[model samples]
Structures are given as structure tokens and as C-alpha cells.
Target: MAARSALAILAALSLAIGGCASQEQPATQPSPGGSATSGTTIKEGLKIAFLPKQVNNPYFDTSDNKGGKPAVEEFKGAYSQTGPSEASPSAQVSYINTLSQQGTDVIVVSANDKDAICGALTEARQAGAKVVTYDSDTNPTCRDLFINQASAEGIAASQIKLISDAVGPDGGEIAILSATANATNQNAWIEMMKTELGKPEYAKLKLVTTVYGDDDDQKSFQEAQGLLASYPNLKGIISPTTVGVAAAARYLSGSEYKGKVQLTGLGTPNQMRAYVKDDTVKSFALWNPADLGYLAAYAGAALASGLITGKEGETFTAGKLGEYTVGKDGTVLLGDPFVFDKGNIDTFDF
Candidate 1:
């Protein structure tokens, strides 16, 4: 993992060096929302701000500080992070307005609501800031690019598979404890999870219900408790949010359901390691959040640099993560989710 981080930093630095010497050329692809510049060199001192769903959240801290901060440093850009402490539909609107007013060149965000922040984001773009949404996204028209951790189908399938494996041949009731109801990414994944459950292979598994945790630890803990109490026959749980998963693990670890009930979802290794070791969780999945933010920073820089416009087939390099293409809907996929269990959970720190 340390080597991976070192390589990522080195790659960003290499991009910076290459940008300085690259010759200018006309953009081959046309942009939808704006025109692409011929400049190949990434501009230094560009003010890049990360507006996550919440401030001081552990997941965002790792993504913004460890991932985004280093990428900005590599590109010689000023970096900052600001947002609400709680994840809510309109919590990020004020921060977006502030960043726009402050003349930020790039605004990387994980939106809480798809449309709630679109107006503020559009205003920022009109003010000349490049909007790049990651982790979660806003309506496509608002952002220049979206850095998706993985495909919604892939993430949903992985979680369903994990829970199915844990529940065994005679699958019973299962429930999802997700983030806020309005979270775009979470809602997308949940819908796909429902689709996956419809398949014949998973016919034995029945989805009991889903509850919202709002990405709050205490609320998620209580929600997990509620789910168990309300559905005493529940056999498994899937929490696709880091906060919800960790909180659910904590609740299950101290209760009678520790080994009897299966738990799996998107979680950082640091938060799920104990649960895995204690037999409270079988396995969970997530892409490296740090890499997700690193890629977002690079994508934002690319937009700001005019290296590539946010158009289908547009390509740009993302440090150690290598080259990426802008797929449909102005989105770049980071990769697939990785499952962590007791066997290899110890190898990761974040």
C-alpha cells in the first residue's frame, strides 16, 4: 500500500513535469458546456477546492487530504476542503457559493443531492470554475466531469454477492442500511441491488427493507439496531456507506447477532478490520477512496488545463492510476470494488 501511494505521487509529479514541456495542440473533441483551449500545460497556482458531502468525515478526510492534497501539491496548485459537517440535500450549497465567490478554479465534490446543489454548481461554472463530482454525482448538466468509483451495477452486485455468500444456500431475509435517501450514488446502487435480487440465482434471498442512516455514526448504529429489532428473522445486512457499515459492525459486534447475522458492504479496512477478525463481518467491498480523490484532482486539473474537454472519448492521465477516458455522461470510472476479509484486511491501512 505504501508503495502504491508512492507510485501515485510519483505519477502526478511526472504529469506535472510533462505538462511543462508539452507542446500546445488543438482539442480534437468538442465540448458540450464550453469550448476547449489549446493549452497543454496545466496552469500552476490554480485554486482547487474539495467540497465533500460532509466535513471532518473519516472517509472524506482520507480522500481529500491523502489523495487530493498530494495531487494538488504535485501539480503546484493551491488546495482546500470545505463543506457542511452533516450530509444533507442542501448542506453544500453555501460552500459551493463561497468557493465560486472566492474564485476557485476547480470544485471537486461528492454531492448529497443530485439537483439540490446543481443551481449553485452551475453558478460556480458560470464564474469559471470547473466542476468535478466524485463519490456521488449531481445532475449531469451541472458538472464538467464525474469520477465514479465503480459502475453502479458492479457495486450493487458485489454487495449482493457478499451477503448471499454469507447467508448460505437457504438465504433468508436481508436489509440494506444505506446513507441518506437523497444520496445519488447510494440510491443508484440500491436500485441496482434490487435488480440483482430479482435474478433466479438469488431467488432464495428476500430483501426485507432498507433504512437511512444519513451517514451519521450514531444514527446508523441506531438504525442497524432498529432493523434487527423490527425484523428478528433477518439473516444479513448490507451497508453501502462507510459510516453505516462501520456503525452496523459496531452494533453487531456487541450484540447476540455477531456471528449469526451476516454483514457486508462498502467499508474502509481500518474500520472493518476488527469486525472481520471478530467474526462480526464476513467481507465487504470498496475502491480506494484516496485513489478516487486523486483521480478527481487530476480530472479537475485536466479540465482546468484544457488537456481534454469533458466529452465522450476524451482521454487524460490520472497520475499512477494511469490514463482514463471520459465515458458516457461525462464520467470516468476509477475501477472495480475490492473485497476485504480477515485473510487480507491486515494488509491495508485505509
Candidate 2:
């Protein structure tokens, strides 16, 4: 029954995204110096690479090192990974430039800023590289396809439910811990969360403030500490980014308010395990990071192989993850977020 409902949710999201934003850079163009037609496919021996928001961030590390690299290897495609040490749009532009110059067949990225990297991405597309945006997205015109983990409405509602359940019916003051101010996915989810709060049942729950951690571990830790000191009456916190959630968890676990203030948001099992065991967090949520990357690699492969041209209703197979079809706006659905608590936290390792 649970499995059935999850599939239904995914189906709904897949249908809804057609009307949403997901512009592929441009349709596939024939390889240079070759006779061209709509049927012409790019050459084999595809070289694929991924550039995430940051290199050392644990969340991206799991996606790239543990998940993405393995999938690329399974398909026998040449694969490489690169990104900035700290996440910023300008910091990623140079990496994009290098990948484009290297003539990588496909470049997968989790955009730091939607528009900041557009010029570089556009240049890469012009250089014959297919762009796939995952985790976060670049502008629709800047990528070939976007691998969305889950629907923003679904993730936001789940976060609201977790905090509401932990804080109880009477409700209380709450705040949000988020990623960079301009993070496309982060901002979209936050907006949905605010809309969720407008429901009558949540009238008593007051949103005290929202803070940014820039997806930095130390900065997020400090931001969590500050929220505690500033909002003495704060009842709960919702952190929608993996980095922010884990860092906030680190701060709340050892603090005096450990059990007093509830924490819930999107996080990986490895990062939130200790907090769940210690009772600092009852529940948090996320999709499988490895699966997210695995699907993305397959999508990049499909584009580079000319199996699909980023058209709605085009289908392709991702090893182990089964088959996926391109939806409206060149969007592909990964899956829904799963909640992790002490009960199920022990079951997942990434």
C-alpha cells in the first residue's frame, strides 16, 4: 500500500511538471564535419563529467563519489568529476569553461546560481556538450534536461508535517535554516513551505525567521546557534538543504535545547543518524542521493547517444533504476523523499 501511494505521487509530479520550467538548451545537433539529419547520432565513446556545487561537501560527495561515479563505470563511459571548493556562481564558471574546452561529451551539474553560469553553459552547449542539471538547476535555456529529485510541493508539505507533528497541535514559534540566498531549489521549496503554513490547521505556528548558511558547515552551525540565542521561545526549525540540516543537527544535538526544540528537514541518513539516535531529531527526509546521480548519468548518456532529443514522451533506460521518460520541458522525475527516524535510520548507510 505504501509503495502504491509513493508511485502515485511520482506519477502526479511527472504529469504536473509539463507546464513547469525545464527548457533544454537546444535540440541535438549533428557532430561537426559529419553529414547531418534528425536521425544522426553522436559518436560513441562518450565522455561524461559531473560538476556539483562543491567538492568536499558530504552531500555532493555521496552523490558524486559513491553514486554517480559507479553508475558511469557500470555503463563503461569515460567519467570525471570536478567542482569548486566552496559554492558560488562565479567559482563554477571557470570549471564550466574548462569542461567545455576539454570537449566532454556530456556535462552534468548542480547549478550554484541559475543564471550566473548561463553564459558558460551556453558556450558549452555550442561546443557540442550536452548539459544535464541535477540537485539544482541552471536556466531552462542553459541545459538539456533537469533531474528533479522530488516535487517542491511534496517536499515542502513533508517538512511541514514533520515539524507540526514534533511540535504538537498547539504549535509554537519556528524558524528556517536554508542554503544560499539564491539557490533555485532552496528558494522554491521555502516559498512552498510558506504557502503550506497558510493553512488553517497551522495558524498557531508562527515563523520567527529564515537564515542562510551558504551551505557551509561552520557557517550553518553558527547560524543554528544564533537562532537558538535569538529566539528563546523558538519551538522548531526546518532546514531544507542537506548541508544546513546536518550542521544544524550538529549544533542542536549538543546544546541545552536538544530535546526542547524540534528539528526537521531534508538530510541524508549518514549525516542525521547520530541526532536521531540521541533524540535531537525525531524525523528528517531526503531521496536517495546515489539514485539521484545514477539516474542523471543515464540521462546524460541518453542525450549524448542521441537516444532522445529532450522531447516530451521520449524514453530511455537507466541501469538498475529502470526506464524513465522525458516529460514536458525536458524534465525527468527521480522519486519522492523518504522520511528517516531512529526506526529506519539504521537501515540506510548513505
Candidate 3:
């Protein structure tokens, strides 16, 4: 991981000196709210800012500090992260506005709401900031590209498989504990999970209900408690956000349902390690949050450097992670979700 991080930093730095910009909105740039023109060029010495759903989040912290910082440092791109402490669209808007006012080159974000931030993102793009969404995404027209941590189906399937394996093939009643209702990735994965549950192999795994934690720790804990109280027959849960899963683990760890109700979802190894050890959780899934940030930084650098336009069939290399081609709708799949269990959990630290 260290080597990979270093490699990312070096790669981004190497490209920092080569970009060129135009006097008018570059040929590749959209005329604000319009589709991007392919082959448009951007300038180098990119100034980058990361506005996550909120500040002080452990997941974002790992990704930005460990992953993004190194890459930005290498490229000599001036990097900063500032956002509202609470995950709200309004809060993010304020930060986005400030970054634009400060003339940031690329604005990397994890949007709280897809449409809510579009206005601010548009303003930033008009101000010449390349908008890149990672983790959670803004509406497609609102950003230049999205860095998806994993395929929605793959993530949904992994979560369901973990919970099903924990509870058994018979599949007792289960529920989804998700982030914000409008969170792009969360909503997409939940929908996919619902569709997957309708399949024949998952016939016995009944989905009783779904709940939202708003990605707040206290709220997620309370929501977990509510799920237990509201659905006594529920046998398993899937929390697809780091904050929600850890909070759910905290709520279940001390309760009588600790071992009785299975909990599995996307979580950082550090945050869920104790829960896994103490039997509050069986197994969970997630990509490396740090790598997600690293990838996003590289993608942003590529866009700012004009290495590849955010167009289908455009390919660029991400440090350590290797080459990735832009897919439809300007999306890049980061790969698969990794399962962490008691046996192998000890092998990972991030």
C-alpha cells in the first residue's frame, strides 16, 4: 500500500508540468450545462480541493490524507479539503463556492445530494474547476467524472452474500441500513440489492424493510436499535456505509442481539476490527478508502492535465492500480469489493 501510494504521487508529479490551457473555454469543456467536447485541453500545476459529504469522517480522512495528499504533493498541486462538519447539501455548497472563489483547479467531491450541489458545481466548472465526484456522486451533468469504488451490483451482491452466509442459505429476514436517502451510490446499491433479492437463489432471503441513518453515527445507532425493535424477526442487516456499519456494530455489541442478529456491510477495517473480534459482526466488505482518494486525485490530475477527456474509450493510468478507461456516463469502476473476516482481518490495517 505504501509503495502504491508513493507510485501514485510520483506518477501525478510527472504529469504536472505538461498541460496547456486556452484563452476561451477549451474545446473539450462544455458550455456550462452542456455536454463536454472531446479532446479539449486543460492546464497543468492543478490546484485541487476535496469536498467530501462532511469533514472529520474516518473514511474520508483515510482516503484524503493517506491517498490524496501524497498524489497531490507529488504533482505539486496545491491541495486542500474543507467542508461542513455535517453532511448536508447546503454545507457542501458553501465549501464549493469558497473553493471556486479561491480558484481551485479541480473540485473533488462526495456529494450529499445529487441535484442539490449541481448549481454550485456548475458555477465551479464555469470558473474553470474540473469537477470530479468520488464515493457518492453528483448528477452526471454536474461533474466531469465519477470514481466509483466498485460496481453497484458487485457491492450489493457482496453485502447480501456476506449477510446470507452469516445467517445461512435459508435466509432469514434482513434489512438495509443505508446512508442518506439521496446519496447516489447508496441509493443505487440499495436498488440493486433489492433487485438481486428478487432472484431465485435469494428467494429464501426475505428483505423485510429498509432504513436510513443519514450517515450519522448516533442516528445510525438509533436506527439500528429501531430496526431491532420494529422487526423482531429480522435476522441480519447490511449497512453499506462506514459510518452506519460502525454505529450499528456499537449498538449491537452491547445488546442481547450482539450475536443473535448478524451485521455485515461496508466498513473500514480499523473501525470494525473490534466488532469482528468480539463477534458483533461476522464479515463485511469495502474497497480501500485511501485508494479511492488516490484514484480520484489521479483522475482529477488527468482531467486537469488533459491526459484524457472524461469520455468513453478514453484511457489513463492510475498509479499502482494500473490503467482504467472511462466508461459510459463518465464513470470509472474501481474494481471489486473485498470481504474482511476474523481470519484475514488481522492482515489489514486500513
Candidate 4:
């Protein structure tokens, strides 16, 4: 009966986690400010800069360079990417201030902390720059629009499903190796994961603990090591961040726990292919980071062009990806996450 219920949950999630359509879904909460407009010309040579959680990070590198940069080029805008080397709350504040002072037309950011960057973002807005937060969000009032990779509920359910499947029906102890504890997206998903775990179907699975790696490679590797040492009976691990999942995979791939413990979470194809091939990881999931950046760039362009305000019911077309609508609280859903394993991992390059 437990097995049946678990499979039922997976079946339902399989239906829910499919790709988001190019049309608008219904809005739940209304946006705080801004009025909608039909369309406008995207100004050429507009100065648009991306400030990621940190500079030189693989995930951000792809999102900003491969995704955001090309979109900026497509729109004929002046693009610049800059941020701190560390993923700290205040690390991005100074960069935000710098971009604002440069009189940038649009500032794209993936905030490290939800509130830490709000004041700076507000100031940027006051200086006539449109603020768009992508990947990770700040408070709703802080930005013009938020480009979310996937819905929080969808992500939470999918991660739980992956770990549950990897650990088998007779689930035992599990732990979460996540990015920084203060990460807005990470915390939102973690809370929903806990809610999912509370269901009777998952009673056999106990979440032993959650450890933060601060999104640092070495620190994530050490956190993975510590989880195993601290909990000998840990049956699986769910790492919701790309850096955390990749670092944990590296640690587990070389250790005695290679095949003994299951690992799954958000990871790029290039990073998790080896682990999937070697069986260190059963499966994992993530949306295309490049596409995320691409969409963000278009959204920023729309805001700067007055094509759409951050208001709900507003729609804009992203190049090559199609149209999307602004959802409640100034949010736009990119799409659902795609899971990767040995079968399909080879087909993906990034």
C-alpha cells in the first residue's frame, strides 16, 4: 500500500512537472505597482547589466554569459555582467550601487538574500533603472519582475520524488545538502519539501538534517562528507542547488558510499553526466540555466521599453522561447524542471 501511494504521488507529479506552455497561467496575487501597456519598441543600445549571486560561478557563468548575453545581443542592447566572487548577502550590494550610478537602463540580478539587497534595488529603481530579479528573488516590492525557473511547489515535489525513488520503497534516513540557508529560493523549496515529507506516503523517510554549503565547492564537498560521518544510516541526499549537488556527487563518487547512498537534486547536464554514468547518482533535475537568463534579458528589455509593466496580466515575447505572462506579485514562471539520468544525460551538452 505504501509503495502504491508513493507511485501515485510520482504519477501526479509527472503530470504537474511538464514544461510550462507559452501562454499565461492564471494570476493568484496582484503585482504591487506599475500599469500594463500593449507594446513598445525596445530601445537600441540600452545599458543592461546582470549581477548574479556571485561572479565566476559555473551556473551563473552559463546563465549570464551564454543565456543573458546573447539575448542582450539579440535585442541590440549594451550588456555587462559583474558581481562579487563570494555569494554573501551584502556582496552584491556594492555592485548594485555601482550599476545604478552608471545610469544603467536595466539591472538584472539573482539576489543572494531576499532583503539584504532590497534597499539597493529600491535605490536603483529610484534612479530610473528597471530592476528584474531572476533565478533567486528579493522581496516582491524590491524588483519590477522576477523570472522564476519553476514553481516552488513543483520544485519541492520533484526533488522529494527523486530522492524517494532513489532510496526505494523501504526509505530510511535522508539529509538535505543545500546552498546558503538564507537563499530565498532554497528556503522556499525546503519548506515545501518538509510539507511534502509530512504526508503519510513518506512516513518511512525521515529527514535527518539540513546542512548549508554556502554555494562554495569545497564547502559543499565538506558538507557532504560531514553528513555521511554524522549519520551512518543516511539512505539518500537531496541537494537543491547546482553547486551543492555537483560537489556532493564528487565526494560520494570517490568514497565508500559510492553506490550505497542515493543522491539527487538540481544539476546541470555537464556537471552530473559523469556521476549518472558511473551510478554515483541515480537521477537529478534542473531547468536550463541559459534559457532562464535568456528570458530574464527579454523581460528586462520589455520593462525598459514599456512593453509590459510588472503588473499581473501583462505579457511579453521572449526571443525564440515564445510569449510569457507576468504572474502574481511580479513573477514569471520559466517552465517546469527536467529530470536527467543515464538514459537522457548523454543527449544534453549543458
Candidate 5:
């Protein structure tokens, strides 16, 4: 059944991206009260802010359309999408200040720097705007709720497994290619991967090195080349950052190591499609970013409308999406990370 699902995904991708056909959105019912929960209503024209790590990245762009825009439209609330051209905390801070001045009822953000944005987020909260972090998170104390894509353990373990499978049972040297050194999510996942790699079950896998790319495509490409030169026996490269994975794949595809080395990590299907189709990368993983955006939008709106308060251990329904129990730390896990390979990579559009 899984294999069949994967084949269907690939077929859909072929049709969508290969220009074989146009894509369509799935029809979904509107949530009760025209929102996720009952008794929550925005002032006919309330405004909410949807900010991401950067603009123009397919990942965040899809989030805007599938996540924030739809929620605002459904509630008849005004929605604005803004962020830095680059994924920088200073840029995000600027936007947050602007949004606060604009009197946004809620601010939903995918933070660029974990701790640096806390001050700004606190200010926004103080100004009566409910704050929620998604895609990435800020300090739990500073934000009302964090909508996590998956648990740190799940993300780390999956990457380790992908590397182990690529290297086979012989247990060869493996290295990591990551984004900026300060990226909170990437650092947490790397730590988790290290822990998983040391377990007895993964005795055959040896992690040799880790390199940072600062999420720059050119820099990531150069880093990939450097890793190949530095680790002559490196069997696989696990890149947890989308930029790193795509850069590594692009580098390997044109180099002698194309099939000699294995590549796997968090990458968008569109960006990594060529590498996957050419067999340069075996597989990668990501959740539906659109769904992530959608959930974040709902959470932001719910918090603002008083339909649901951002209390730890609180349970509430997110309109038509169903019920969600807030964890002890005010964090909400959307679910596990979805693995994508040749089998199912084609089915998803974003």
C-alpha cells in the first residue's frame, strides 16, 4: 500500500511539474462559525500578520497561500504577508515593529533567529497582539504558542535512518551539511541526529563531520565540494536544511560523485525534483508546509478571537481541522514528518 501511494505521488508530480496537466486545490468544508471554533469572531475587518523566514522561497510562499491567506479570507479578516528578503532576525524584527505599529490583532511568525526575536515578540505581545510561532519557534516564554511541524526526536531519527540506509550495512563515514550555525531548529535536529547515531542499533553508522552553509546556495554548493575533498571515504551526506540539500544535490549532480555518494535531507519536492529524477539523491523528507501555514493561521486567529486561549495543556478545536491538545509548554505538534522518495515524491505539489 505504501509503495502504491508513493507511485501515485510520483505520477502526480510528473503531471504537475512536467507540465502534463494543471493542478487543483482539494475542496474542504469551512469550519463552524466560519472559523475553527465556536464563539470566536473577529471584528468584521480585523488584520493579522503572516511572516515567514524569507520571501520568494517556494516553501514559505506556499505557506502564505495555503496557510495564512485562506484563514484570513475565511474569517473575513485582513491578512498581510511580510518578511525580510533574507532570513535574518534583524529583518524580522523590523517587520514585527511595523506590524505592531499597524495594530495587528495577531502576529504569526516563522522566526529567523530563535532568541534574538524575543524582545520584539514581547513588545508585540505587550501591544495586545497575540503572538504565535510556526515553521520555526521563538522562546516559549515569549510566544503564546508554537506550532511545531514535528518533534525534534522524529526529525533527527529520520535523517539518521536515511543516512544509514544509503550507506548500507557496512557502516561507512557520513557527514552533515547544515544551514546557519545559529539556526535553532537545525541545531536541535543535529544534536538529535548525533544522539541517534550513537545508539547501539546504529553501530554501523559513523558520523565523521558537520559543516555550516549559512543557508546560502552558493556557499552550500562550495561546502559540498569541500566535504567531498576533505572526506575521501565519506559515504553519505545528511543535510537537514532545505538550502543545503538542494545545493548539495546540484553540486553532486554535475560532479564525479553524482552516484558515488548518497544525499538526503529536508528539501522541497520542486527544488530537489531534478536530483531525485536523475538519481542523484535517493530521498528526502518534509511535511506539507501549506498545512503548517494553515494550522498557524488558525492558531493565530483562534488566539486573537478568544475562541481559544494560549494556555498550556488546553484542548480546543481548530474549526473544521478537528481537535488539538496543547502540550505542557504551549507547543502543538502538527504530526510526524512525512518521508518523500521516488515512490511518493511526485504526488505532492508543494
Candidate 6:
């Protein structure tokens, strides 16, 4: 029953976003004194900069407009989202430097390369800008907060479960289609999935191969095709990246193995809907990105307003968002992974 529902949702998402897969970047300006109206008495006109891994991906674009910008406006601060045209850590470092030099009060970022961007984040902190990581995280010591959408273990385990289920109780050959070889989150999740696959319950599941898509739609699509050609008995594909998932689904949907091979991974509802409808993918998981952005803003505002410092084990209330506790490592898990399927996919527009 669960598998059937997930298949339906994936189809819906593919139909919704596949035709308009071209990335769009939207700019958000401060609402007219909406920040002041929130009535949090703090120094007025604070400036916060949000740096995503890339500027054009719909995932981060939604975060900027729906999550970060409104939170800034509610706090009577200025917010801007900027990053490179592509996911380049070096470019992100340059933007961090520029924001720091401009005397920004806070800077939140989704890192492109985890270690490569640490120095820049540390430098921003030294320049009196509170550094926070959202989406993809940096080194814990380098940033004050990490706004986690979900725990690393939880996300990876869920993907493994989805694939294990799709391949049946008696698992067979499977492969992973991942984004960039060096992606921190992807690597972490892949590792966890590997561990999960080793469990006795999944003894028959064999992760035979791994491929990189570099988060490029074309590259991912080609990689999926190559995997299919290389492994005739490939039972499932766990694409941990959003781009990889969509690309794999599209490839499978058009192939003779449409329902024979299962594709499961993290993807936006709008991007994987069609594949689900065609029964190319069984299930996938992701947190609400907009809520992630919203929570990130809430955390940033709480810190800026002196409501809560970025200390481990600290707790604070985000207006209308309820309470959150800072974990021992300065990371905050927003919530559980949202598993989307037919039953509830239509209920969520984003």
C-alpha cells in the first residue's frame, strides 16, 4: 500500500516540474516595515545574507524567497540571497568575503565544498558576522549553527529502506547515482546507506556500483542510462541527489525497464511526479525545504535579537514556530524526513 502511494506522488511531481525544469532565481525584497511590525525590539535594519550552493536551483531558490527573506523582513532586517551561477565552493567563498567586508551582521550558507568553505566562514566569523550553515553543512567548529533538515542517519536509512522494499524481501543488484563525488551530504548519506544495507535484514541487497552526476541534469541522465546498460539485472537505484533522482526516473520511464527497475532518492515533488505516475519510481524522501528556510531564519533572528545565543544545549522560541534546542554540536534538526506518496502529495503544492 505504501509503495503504491509513493509511486503516485512521484508521477505527480514529474508531471509538475519536468516540463519547466529550467531553474529560476527569484529576488525578494523586504516587506514594508513587516520586520518592525513583528515587534521584536532589537537594533533596526539588520543585514543578513543567505548564500546557497548555487543561485538557480529551485530547491535553494524556494528557501531564499519563502524561508529566509520573510524571516529577515519580520525581524526588521535586510536579506539578500546570492551565490555562484553553479555550485562552486570557491565562488561561495568569494561571496562570503564580500558579505563580510560589507559589514553584514549574519551570513547563512549552504556549502558547495564542506572543507573548502570553512576558512571563508571562519573569516566571516572573525569579521563579527555570525556564521550559520543550512542545507549542506560545513565544519561544526567553523559555524555557530547548522540548520539541519533531517539527521544524516535518518535520511540515508530511509533511502535504503525504500530501495530494499522495492527490490523485494530478497534483494538483488543495486547502484547509487550521487551528486558530485565530494559533496559532504551525499557522501555522508551514502556511507550511512552502505551501513544500513549491511544489516541482516538486507543481506541480499548488493550495492554493485556508484556513479556521479555532478548535479547536472544531462550528466545524471546519461549516467543512469550507462548504469542500465552496464548492469542488466540492476534491481534498484538509490539516487541521493535531487537532480540524480529526477534524471534516473526520466531515463527509466522511457526505457523498457520502466517498472522493472525502481528509482528512489531525494527529489522535489514537482520534479518527480510524472515518473511516479508511470511507475518508474516507487518512493523517495525529503524534508520541507521552505520550512527549513523558515526555521533557519527563525534561528538567525533569534540569535540576532539576543533571544538565544548559538551555544550548544541552548533553547529558544521562534515566533509561531515553537521551541528549538541547540544540540551539542551546534546543529538543529528541524524534523523527520517527509516521505511523499500518492495519498498526500496533492495536498502539498510546494
lDDT of 5 by residue, 166-223 (tens): 7788878899998777778888899999999889878977888999887778999999
Q: Give the TM-score of candidate 4.
A: 0.90
Q: Please report how far candidate 1 places residue 239 from its true position, in Å.
A: 0.3
* lDDT, model 4, position 9: 30
TM-scores of the models, in the order given: 0.90, 0.88, 0.87, 0.90, 0.87, 0.86
Higher-scoring candidate on TM-score, 1 or 2 = 1
User: Residue 100 of candidate 4: its Cα lDDT?
Assistant: 94
Q: Compared with the true structure, what per-residue lDDT tens digits does model 6 show for residues 1-350?
A: 01124454344334323322122212122223122232334445878889988887878876777667765666567989988977766778889999999998888898877899899889888888888789888878888888987888989889989998888987899999998887778888889999998899999999999999988889999999999899999999999888889999999998998889988999877787777766787778887676677678767766665555676666655433445777768887776676766555555555
Each candidate's root-mean-square deviation in Å?
A: 5.5, 7.0, 7.1, 6.5, 4.9, 7.2
Q: Please name the candidate that would achieve the greatest TM-score relative to the true structure.
A: 1
Model 5 clash pairs are 6-343, 6-344, 9-346, 9-347, 10-346, 13-346, 36-319, 67-294
For candidate 2, what is the TM-score? 0.88
* Maximum-lDDT candidate: 1
Candidate 4 displacement at residue 237 in angstroms: 0.5
Candidate 2 lDDT score at position 277: 94
Q: Model 3 over residues 1-350: C-alpha lDDT tens digits?
A: 11234344333323321121111121222222223344333344688888889889999997787677666765557778888898776778888899999989889999999999999999999999899999998889999999988889989898888888899876789999998888889999998999888888888998888899988999999999999999998899999999999999999999999889999999988899999999999999888777688778878987877676688767666654556778899998876777788987776666
Candidate 6: residue 98 lDDT (0-100): 94
Q: Give me the displacement of residue 230 in model 6, in angstroms.
A: 1.9
- Model 5 misplaced stretches (Cα beyond 4 Å): 1-44
Q: Model 3, which residues run further than 4 Å from truth?
A: 1-44
Best of the two (1, 5) by lDDT: 1
Output candidate 3 Cα RMSD: 7.1
Whole-model lDDT per candidate? 0.86, 0.82, 0.81, 0.85, 0.77, 0.76
* Model 2, span 1-350: residue lDDT tens: 01225555444333222211122122233323222234533334678899999998878777776667766666667878998999887899999999999999999999988999999999999999999999898889899999988878888999998999999988999999999998999988999999999999899899989999999989999999999999999999999999999999899888899999999999988888999999999999988777678778878877887767787767766665556767778788887787778886776666
* Candidate 1 wrongly placed segments (more than 4 Å): 1-37
Model 4 regions more than 4 Å off? 1-39
In candidate 4, what are the lDDT values of residues 1-350, reduced to their tens digit?
01123334333233222322223222112222346443455667889899999998888888888778877887788989999998999989999999999999999999999999999999999999999999999999999999998889989999999999999999999999989989999999999999999988898999999999999999999999999999999999999999999999999999999989999999988899999999999999987787788789888988888777888877777866666788899899987777888887776666
